[model samples]
Target: MILYTTTPIEMIFPCDQTVFDNYKTISYQGVPLVVEQTDNHYRIVQILSSNPNDFMKEELAPGQLISFI
Candidate 1:
């Protein structure tokens, strides 16, 4: 079936609560980001900054792995 809706897919097909447990919002290098914890680093989930320049940084790109000190 073809489903057309503005609602996010996650809301339609809810994910497990445990799936969200590893995700968190943090300020990295003064930029707000949503990241998922991996073995030794965090995988960028989303950039929450309003500044366009924030998106220009390759290190902060979504899906990039970052090690937090």
Candidate 2:
């Protein structure tokens, strides 16, 4: 039931298993993502890796700090 903005124009609704124990990070197709909590929704803060594939997801791409709000 969690929503994340992985790309500038897209959002990824990952399952509960994708959420990390810390609740600050999540795995989307194996890419670790950090998110910032907004008043109404969550925003993509950063990618926890430098791998090109990490930012290649249609939803969570580099330079695309998408917000669900």
Which candidate has the highest lDDT of all?
1
Per-prediction tally of clashes: 0, 3
lDDT of each residue in 1-69, candidate 2, tens digit only: 554644523234345543432236666557788775545555566787769866667677633454544
Each prediction's TM-score against the native? Answer: 0.78, 0.42
Task: Give the alpha-carbon lDDT of every model.
Answer: 0.85, 0.57
Please write out the lDDT profile of model 1 over residues 1-69, one tens digit for every residue.
878964347634648877678788899999999888989999998888989999999999989999975
Superposed Cα deviation of residue 18, candidate 1 (Å): 0.7
Model 2, residue 55: what's the lDDT? 62
For candidate 1, the TM-score is 0.78
**Residue 20, model 1, lDDT:** 72
Error of 2 at 44 (Å): 0.6
